[model samples]
Each structure stands twice: as C-alpha cells, then as structure tokens.
Target: MNTPAALTLEAPAEHPFAPFVRILGKGKRGARNLTREEAREAMGMLLEDKVEDTQLGAFLMLLRHKEESAEEMAGFTEAVRERLTAPAIQVDIDWPTYAGKKRHLPWYLLAAKCLAQNGVRIFMHGGGAHTAGRLYSEQLLDALAIPLCRNWQSVNEALDTGNLAFMPLQDWAPHLQSMIDLRNTLGLRSPIHSLARILNPLGARCGLQSIFHPGYQSVHREASSLLGDNSIVIKGDGGEVEINPDTLSHLYGTTAGVGWDEEWPALSARRHVKPASLQPEHLLALWRAEVEDSYPQLALLSTMALALRGLGTPREQAFEQAQRFWDNRDTSI
Candidate 1:
C-alpha cells in the first residue's frame, strides 16, 4: 500500500460566505465559530446573492456538520428580518410552519383558523413539500379557504378580512427558500431551516414556533431571548406547531426578555397513534362539524392553548379560552 500524504486546500479569497465556510471547516484546531457580527454579514451576503452556488452549498453543509451556534442563528435571523419587504401590518402572532406533516393531517390549521376567528391576527410563513412523502400546510390552505398570499399587498388584504394569511417562504424570502430546496441534495437540514423559523419577519410581539429535535429547543429559546421576542418553542408533532396530545411537551422560550420554560402534560392516557390515512379534507370537515374525530379536536385545542399562552394569556386560562374560541368559531369561513 502507498503511504498517504497530507494535502492543503484553500478557499477562494473573493467568495462571500467563504470565510464563514473556513471558520467552520478549517480542521479541528483552526476551525472556530463565527462571531454574531460575522454571521450577520455572511448571511446578508447570502441574501444578496453575493456567494456563488458552490460556495453556498459548501457553507451550509459545513455549518450543518458543526451544528449552528445560537449566536450564529440569531445573526442569520436578523439578516433575514432586515431583508423582508412585508408592509407594516398589525400581527398578533408570528407562526412559522417549516416542518411539513407526514403521519398526521395538519390539525394545527384548524387551530390557527380558530385563533383568527377569535380576532387574533396571525402571520404565518413556510415552504411546501421540500421533502418527499410530506404533506405541507400550503397544500391544505385552499381547502381550508385560507388565502395563500403571494405578495405583501395580498397579505395585507387577506389579514384585513380573514385576520390570517399564509405566505410561502419562496414569496417571502426567496434566498432562504432556495437553501431549503437544497434538502434533497444536502441529505440533511442546514442552519437555514432553524434561521427561517426565527425570522419573525413582521417583528410580531409573540411567536409560536417548533423544531423537530429536542436539542434545538434551547437554540430557539436562546436565540429568541437574544432577539427579545416573546416566543415559545416546542418539539411539535411531525415538527409542525401542532401539539402532540400523547406526550408531555417541554416548552422553552423568553417572556419579555427573560428566559422561562413550561411543561405541558399530555392530553390523553391512551397511547398516541397516527391515523392510517391523512386526509386533508378531514380538517375542513372537522371544522364544519361534519367529522367528529376526538384526536384532531384535542390537537386543535392543545395547539391553540400554546398559541394563547404565547400571546400572553395566563397559562391556566389559555386552554379554557381556546376551547371557548373553538366552540364559537365561524364555520362559514
């Protein structure tokens, strides 16, 4: 066998996000995390398309390999926030739905609709079907009769009448959406996935968000705390914001710039089981009282309780208030 020799590689001097890639990939001792400021600049360059496609791919994978720091995520989120062109609108909640549902119909859509009918203005944004075998929120919005806003003007109009609107990530933040689309090639999620959730583009006073991984709870909590937004992060069902009524959910977040956590006990003693089939229309039917599924009803109420808490309702009263809203929701919408 021939003896192996060490080889040195160099990042292009002129490439944007190159320095960021080096900071993450420069071998054990040489690699270091980016300062929040550096991360902001790097992400700004990314949003501006200052980095080449190859450089962008390498940067994302390198960041994924090392995992993202809360500071880095906070910085990247700041960059995305600064780039948003959404017109000023009164939004009560910033709901980011990135993780598409697979095993369950998106019961959380009913939760949001309930909240909207109760006069809460919700600004929701997300991508659709980035991964195969997943059912995304956008796929069901039409059936729910919720407007999928294509631009800031449309968003304003929808929120004006419906008190809720869903903006596709591609329409709201094309750069980050492009990165999300790379999931098929990367074979793993990049930091952009986490960053987009915290964008809170409208700078809403409260945020309702979730992550697939439990460890990411701290990343989201710390980042939101740093951003000084009253937000709640949970390990949601199928990684969507829908609460899992079958297991305890440890919620982590910051309230008025102070870090706090709350544990929500499971809603049912029966073992949580996914439905054999995920029918999007079932959501509408349930809303219309045409279908009477116990689990979906529990999921809608549980999810709304969390949203109510995030909106500053006292924890003990939130569920009751959510149920009240659910009972009185406008079926005509």
Candidate 2:
C-alpha cells in the first residue's frame, strides 16, 4: 500500500526556549526551578529576542506561579548585567523604583534627594506606569527639578552635578521594559518586576529593594548573596523602598556573600491614617518644609535612615545622620 501523505512529512523540531518552559511547567511532580545555568541561558534567549510570544507568556506565567528561586533570579540578573553598558560614573546607592506609590506620596523620592544633597550619588531607575492609580517617580521628576536622563551621557551629567539621576528602564533596557509592560496583558506581574529591582546595572556598592509581598524579602536577600551583592530588602510602605514609620519593618540583607537580618522598630506608637489622596505636590512641599506634616517627616527620615544603613553605616548613626540631613536640607529647591 502507498504511504499516507501524512507519513511523508517530518515533525517540527522543539523550540530552543521550550525546555525552559518545560522545566517550570512539567506538572506538580516533574516541575522544578530552573538551574542557574539554565536560567541564564533562558533569559539570555529572551533578551536576545529569540523567544516566541507564546513561549514568552507561558514562561513568565509559569515562573510567576512557581515563584522564582534565588538561583533563577541570580542567573537572570547575570544575563542582564552582561548586556548592560553601565555608565563610567560611580554611584553610592542603587535605588530601583519599579513599584510606584499607591497609598502615600513617594516619600522615598524626597529621601533620595536628601541623601543626594549630603553627597550620596544615587542612580534611580524605574519603568513607566504600567499599573494604574500609582504615583510614579517620573511624574514627580519635573516638579522636584530632578534631571530625567534618557541616555548615559545625560546620566553622567545628572550624577556629576546633582549627585543623583533618574533613568526610566525603557531608556536603557528596552527588552526588559517590554516585558514589564505586559503587566496588563498578563493580569499579574512577572518575574521581571523582582529581577529588575536587583539588577544594580551600574554595579553600585549598595542595592536597596523593597517588596510588598511577604517571603520574597528573603528570596531577594538570598539572590543578592548569590550575586555577591551588598543589598537590603525590606517590606517597605506600599512596596516602594520607603520605610513606614507606623510598622515594625524587617530588613533582609546580604553583605559579601553572607546573609543577615535586622528589624527596625516602628517610629510611631500608633498607626497613622492613610492619606485620602496621594498628592505629588506634597512631596515638593514636604521637601521645602512649606507643610510640616509629622507623618511625612517621619516617613522621609526613616526611609533615609534605611538607605544609610545599606551604605554600611551603623544603625544609630544612620538614623542620626538621616535626621541631620533632613534638618539641614536646602529649602531653595
């Protein structure tokens, strides 16, 4: 009998990226986290645009469901860092502001400005407002007169003159930015959110990250250790890197490949009510001391103290220094 027409054709080869998806989606028993090497290769392919859209979505959602492991995060970060062209400027702190503030003003912006004024060179990076109803850093940049850099040349200029610079992720890392933009399509944040926070692209000495989700703090801490990064991960207010004065915040950190943890006592004896609305103008007013709200002041100082601690200052000294910086801030901004 003649062979059927179907027998004449060959089966298509497996996709290069399918293995990664399989590793994460191989069912409850067979599924497992991607090894560091596998993750690096997988992310490398994604960054290189070799992944199909279907595979990309599947991979992201699968990883999101599984929750990325330290190995995976460290590996993914390695792949990105390898591709980034860091500026030749030195930075004291690597502040990743991917999570926009929803409940309160971005007090961390004021805290960063205070640190910058005191000679701390900070590199702040964030994505656009992929999620709605949050106040993003870029929105307040013009009001605060902080330079919004579009390229390395501008970043160099901003850091040189102001000791601080803000760059949106799309300006430098468009590939990752595209992934972050999928929040609405995917209906949930992918690993890109957490991975971007730990990138520390300029390789700063101190990396500060804040996560809203519980348990992920230790994941970030452990991932930083794998990368030999000196980092502090906290459950900050509204998921931005600003400490809440009303809650006792736990700090998960790593230094020189060693892991450690600390607790910062709440600055307030009682919980403060959330603002009826988040006003970006309040950030500028708070900085100018035009409005002397106690909650914002505590929020700013406590956030600054957390940054200082990441820079290796002792706990008490960091708090004192933060207070001093706030008290002596130049109101003429």
Best by TM-score: 2
Off by over 4 Å in 1: 1-16
For candidate 1, the 10 contiguous residues with the lowest summed lDDT are: 11-20
TM-score of 1: 0.94
**Which candidate leads in lDDT?**
2
**C-alpha positional error of residue 52 in candidate 1 after TM-score superposition, expressed in Å:** 1.9
Report the number of clashing residue pairs per model.
0, 0
In order, candidate lDDTs are: 0.87, 0.91
Spell out the clash pairs found in candidate 1: none
Candidate 1, residue 274: how far the Cα is off, in Å: 1.7
| lDDT of candidate 2 at residue 13, scale 0 to 100 | 100
Q: Each candidate: RMSD to true structure?
A: 5.4, 1.5
Could you tell me every candidate's TM-score relative to the true structure?
0.94, 0.97
